[model samples]
Target chain A: MNLAFTEIQETIRMVQMESLDIRTVTMGISLRDCIDSDFDSMNNKVYEKITSYAGQLRPVAEQVEKEYGIPIINKRISITPVAELLGHASKDQAVQLAKTLDKAARDLGVDFIGGYSALVHKGITKGDQTLLEALPEALSVTERVCASVSVATTRTGINMDAVKQMGEIIKEASELTKDANGIACAKLVVFCNPVEDNPFMAGAFHGTGEGEAVINVGVSGPGVVLNALKRHSDADLGEISEVIKRTVFKITRAGEMIGRVVAERLSLPFGIMDLSLAPTNAMNDSVAEILEEIGLERVGTHGTIAALALMNDAVKKGGAMASSYVGGLSGAFIPVSEDNGMIKGIEDGALSLSKLEAMTCVCSVGLDMIALTGDASASSLSGLIADEMAIGMINKKTTAVRVIPVPGKSEGEMVEFGGLLGRAPVMGVNPFSSEKLINRGGRIPAPLQALIN
Target chain B: MEQKRAVVSVVGKDQIGIIAKVTTCLSENKMNVLDISQTILQDFFTMMMIVDVSEAEDLAKLHDDLDKVSQELGLKIDIQLEDIFQTMHRI
Candidate 1:
């Protein structure tokens, strides 16, 4: 037979029975040329460039989806960090540029436009400060603009000053959008060692080193992995890892193919395929469920981290074998709100903030899509970020924090951000203050790992 | 020129004329069925057809026509380009 019947059936089962999908086709457009001292002209250029480049993104993605019969969930755009273009601009100008980005995203029919961002790991420049100051207001005012701030890296250690300010900025962002349960904070991410070409938001952005325009794809298949593991339920961990690796290889291959098609249609350069098992709120599509299927009683139990480490490593190994360009946080994503199983784990008293933090040490992204008490102190938030950042710094891996302090909501209360963003139960934060430690406001010097060079 | 191939998958409860109706739609759309397989597992019908759609004027229209037949027969149908299956499942 030219095509094996079983193979065709298996592919159909993966897409139809399981919820395998291409999570996003993100176009990263460089806005470095949009820079101007005149904020208005710069904003116009940014909008024009994004609209021109990404105008056909949705139609092309839809056509590809129809042709391939694979669900392409989101068509998004990421740009050069807005801060880089705000060198001589004021805080108000930064906010205006953010609005321009929001308008561009809407015009292009994309779900989100990231890169309202600043990389302040070493120290904050004047432009970085302005962007940081405008983050809370910009996020609150815009619907589709996503923001990220890089506050730590392996080469240059954590910037405690920016970390401290980020705590306040997060609080302000939450309070400003308190009526909607601080949904704005859900669109913001704080990262240590942010990748240059992540296709996922709220961390996607075209980095300084990327080309003029590039198309990156993110593939999601926690359900596919879970289904694969189910077939080998009695297998040992080594064999289980093998199953995961094989499954990831297939998923990554599909993503790379779709990415090539999309980039070719758009006449842009293909960047990378991010092979992440990103879960949705849909049932049976949870990373936590995959962990549970690996013989854990629940997601946050004793063997959870080890199981996640196995899966993450196996995914990367398989993805590396499948695609030459595997960038972004290419492993299992454990976003609390976005995964139904994680929410169940939290509701069952099996998962806690500390436990999730520990799991982040082994997973792709860190402390993502978690919600905190409305009254959680800024010091505690900063301390939590500092801890996650330290893990990334010491281990030299990417880690991020996207905790939303949903105003007027207490621990165990539900805060719904509607479709895709999902609903998160406000998890409790440490009551004690870390003000003294956070207020030190100096760079946490690079760890010994930095000496590898 | 090489024929443009597609996979037409139909799934539903087992019933008579499932294959006949699907092939009629494909023929009306000027698609030639290259390979076909059907199975009945405990009264559930599942079939896969590798069809050459090069002569079909509009692939999307053919898809919609097949979908309309699938709905009338109370079945789920999907028409996917062959490349998706080959690229993903093959090395």
Candidate 2:
């Protein structure tokens, strides 16, 4: 391969191993039309729409991945919540509708199906509660079903009732899927200030405001960024920043090209580009590998917070310069089970749930891949989620919790989601500090600290 | 009677651990690495090592084990059969 750079080669440089393109060109196919009391018609319409619109998506994405020689990891679909589609039906009916979606995704070879969800940030409506109540069974029965419950927002503060309810739902979810260590719970995400066009999951949803279909590309390049950082080992921090800025500019541009192409072909609007470092099961290219290169002996370590902070800031600085409409959670991620380096670290005694949470204080999300005991209390799980969610509220950044509570499992055991979900070694939780305070429920008021002076 | 030949290609950022880990895996697997050409481009360390596993019963096992080692050390390894490399890339 031509390694040297020339004036003409600058264009060619955008597509290389040191460059990571976005994982998916996810077309948010709105399921608003599928809303009906009759489950048959609604399910049929939803299934037909995604399979037809998304049939060509995989082939086109594969063509790009090969031609550009940059791996686009996942080809996924996000839609309106299944619960919303069954607004007119009973709660049990919505669960049936979600199974239909799971089947549709399986038929289409879409690996994971998101948007089996509810938004109870204000208060749980009958439909929202029904969806929430149906979540554990709905998520557990379906192979690829991913669920989300939104219980907080900056403008709306938080729904303490919803939070408390989710705590119970999570507990029940663990009981149902205990053998899988509540692996279904890993597919469930709780978000504060969640994004609509998120190309990542188990939290992505096709926001209500979107068109019938809009192609949103989530670009990733932690590997590419680490490769760039490798070039400047002897250089100072300022020089390092410049190196990352230049690298991120090219990576984001590659995503723009793919998104534009996919949108044009699908005859849909191009949505916002999520320039996040989404990692996969790939050996050397995962996000945890990037963190290890950041001088951490392992991913969940003492220096990880500082490393992720630099990565998060530099990625934005560079991506902002490259593209005008950079959206989504535009930061580095360290979801332990999703990444191989993290798995190895957990296996090697180099990572912990506490350290992962500490890193999330600076990075994206907190204790993301943690697997808890199935027997753990409802109030405790809520406390766990609330502790992480509070970080996002305080920092004014999007923080999410997608923990798997494994029934009959304890710390030091492993919950294997296999493949991309990987296997996460269960990390111990704090024994008893937050139980009383967490049970005492109300909206924790916004932090006065984040206010602009 | 033969040096069971295999090609190893490493593609990743230049880090201090690359050399130490690569050599260690090769030694532990009882393979003599022949003809090692290493270069650093920008920050990427690209190394091609021709390993001799003449004493081994299974070269595939060695390759797979070293693949894990390559990942732990944060490098990518491409293990090719000895005869395949000789026919292609006539440099």
Give the per-residue lDDT digits (tens) of candidate 1, residues A53-151.
Answer: 889999999999998989999999999988888988989888888888888888778999999999999999999999999999999999999999999
Query: In model 1 chain A, where is the ten-residue run with the lowest total lDDT?
Result: A1-10
Q: Model 1, B1-91: lDDT tens per residue?
A: 7988999998898887988999999999899999999887567788999999889899788878988898899999999999888987777
The top-ranked prediction according to TM-score is: 1
> How good is model 1 by TM-score?
0.98
Q: Which stretches of candidate 1 lie over 4 Å from their true place?
A: none
DockQ, candidate no. 1: 0.81
DockQ of each: 0.81, 0.02
Error of 2 at A28 (Å): 0.4
> In candidate 2, what are the lDDT values of residues A26-84, reduced to their tens digit?
76888887676677887788889888878888877766554333567778889886666
lDDT of each: 0.92, 0.73
lDDT of candidate 2?
0.73
TM-score of 2: 0.78
Interface RMSD of 1: 0.9
- Candidate 2 docks at the CAPRI level of incorrect
